[model samples]
Target: MSRVSNMVAEFVATFPTTLRPGVLYVSGAYSTAAHLCCCGCGHEVITPLSRAQWVLTFDGTVSLRPSIGNWTLPCRSHYFIDSGSIRWARRYSEPEIEANREHDRQLLADARIDTPGGRHPLIQYCRSVWRRLRRL
Candidate 1:
């Protein structure tokens, strides 16, 4: 698909109810970034900020280190967000995907953050519980 070449970053305290395509919503308060799939697929990609995952660099423009690979998504788009520009990357095969997964696993192990989506399992669980309690 002919994808959009550029993306706009918006700072938000909290993610909105929905994400707009090509608009990267960066929330420093949450240390997270969210956006629609750049490959024209409407999947919401939530990239958590962490040592084992993406490292966001924002200076007017934004760059997310370690290109994003949507292995779980059907589109499986791979690209680098460089200075608010979308740099499309070559598609990875299943074997390559497995290798990438292994690399990610090693990074997670080294960082001792073994939860899914690069988040601490206990922390997320506790946060969820607290949110639930707040709702009560």
Candidate 2:
């Protein structure tokens, strides 16, 4: 039954792959006027309002705006996922999210006063994210 066992193992591994969320990465590095959002902890910061959702499937279909549409950023205090399907803020590690926070700050700084490269850098970054998502 070695063959059977191998097949079962493969199937089990592929199961989660089939259900894996198509979103590869999201850029939480944007700025908007709606920054002050009540963190469940009662604090707030300048965070993105929401973001579009792109769904990549194992079947080779990239849905930019799926039936569910894009996700929502619950203020600058939470991370929106699956195009508003899921909202999370405390789910991520403090350190890693700090990096996202810094990145967002830099993006705002660049986008604000039309710094050097201007918004081109932010667009490039989002484009890079799109490309990476397509690969999966």
Candidate 3:
């Protein structure tokens, strides 16, 4: 069941060779988080930490900003990580997904966080996502 619900936060300098379910591994050095999909599909989910993307919050428990929508995954799991709990969100239509994706791309493009890095970060991110999907 995707109801494996609560996730334990483990701070790491980088991701480990294998991912375990119900554990949100956070890398402060990389400003990223990774975990097996909350839907129990075993697919890995990586959320980049940034103002333009997901932000990490640590009050009592850890939380990731926004929601995670695994639309490409077979389960299409959608949920929020709030204070270590998985709060499932409603599923979106294909059109809504595309619109949201495009909007996110626009946000990255607008940020121009890549100018200093030479290549467009959005492009690199999209390419990495494409490669991952291709494997899927």
* C-alpha lDDT of residue 13 in model 2: 10
Model 2, 1-136: lDDT tens per residue?
A: 0100000001111112122222222232331212122233322222232232122222232212222211134333334333223333354456766765576567566566664545454455545554565566
TM-score of 2: 0.27
lDDT tens readout by residue for model 3, 5-120: 89888877679999988999876656678999988888999998765688767665978878999988898999999998999999999999999899889877866654665344
State model 2's lDDT.
Answer: 0.31
Ranking by TM-score: 3, 1, 2
Q: Which structure among the candidates has the greatest TM-score?
A: 3
Q: After superposition, how far is residue 95 of candidate 1 from its true place, in Å?
A: 0.9
RMSD of each: 6.9, 15.0, 8.7
- Kindly give the number of clashing pairs for every candidate: 0, 3, 0
Please give the TM-score that candidate 1 achieves against the real structure. Answer: 0.78
Candidate number with the higher lDDT (2 or 3): 3
